[model samples]
Target: MLRITPRILAVACIASGLITAACASYAPTPSSDLAGTSWAVQSIDGQPTSARSPSVEFAAEDRISGAGGCNSFSGVYEAANGAISVRALGRTEMACEGGVMLQEDAFFAVLDGAERYARQQDRLVITADDGRALVLAPL
Candidate 1:
């Protein structure tokens, strides 16, 4: 049977280099900074929510994957210039406690309405048309 061990997990993290805290300071436009990076959700709607470790990674072929605090998700995305769009977004339906599932719902809602994105140092700010926003830092 396939199993995940702590050592394997650590190795995977190191190999993916998804930790944003230790990354070098890279200042750039949102598109370039976001095209090929994994970002961790720091806040939603301007306030930090008790969502478990949530993150998003933008990949080539218009693909994306990450956690929504409660469950892992993967889907397609389209980002160009400073505009961003997330389509076909899908996530696991696992039930979670502590309002994590609610946070996930809110997070996806913001993403669905996402209109613009900006890069502030290592942070990626995605704002919706309704002024809602998701603050993410390089993961």
Candidate 2:
């Protein structure tokens, strides 16, 4: 039989309290002000996109979804202040023509390397560490 001694009970309570405090302190930070905003890519890497420009939508749950010129992609994004990151990106595996495929690849590359973002009065620019950028406007 297991006996509950005073010392054992005290240790267990202390451990439990410590665990609870740690868990509470580890809660996720608040979402960014960009939450719930949506934009359509107007230009990528300083060049204009074709008629079928890509789009991006930022959801409140740290989710991001968008078109990649030829494929639809979804991923989780985290942003704090002006810095941003994208991870867990998954996309459809559809094929397209040469030019469309090239454009799609460029778009995905920039997103994969996203480092910072800014919102101007009527435009949003996402920039990568290597200086690649995506300029978008409201959808």
Q: lDDT of model 1 at residue 43?
A: 92
RMSD of each: 16.4, 4.9
Q: Candidate 2 at 112: error in angstroms?
A: 0.5
TM-scores of all candidate predictions against the true structure: 0.72, 0.77
Model 2 clash pairs?
A: none
Which candidate has the top score in lDDT?
2
TM-score of 1: 0.72
TM-score of 2: 0.77
In candidate 2, what are the lDDT values of residues 1-139, reduced to their tens digit?
Answer: 9999999999999999999988785544448876888899998899999987888988888999989889999999998888999999999999999888888898998999999999888999999999999999998
84 Cα displacement, candidate 2 (Å): 0.6
* Clashes by residue pair, model 1: 18-139
Please give the distance, in angstroms, between residue 53's alpha carbon in candidate 2 and its true position after superposition: 0.4
Candidate 2 residue spans exceeding 4 A from truth: 1-30
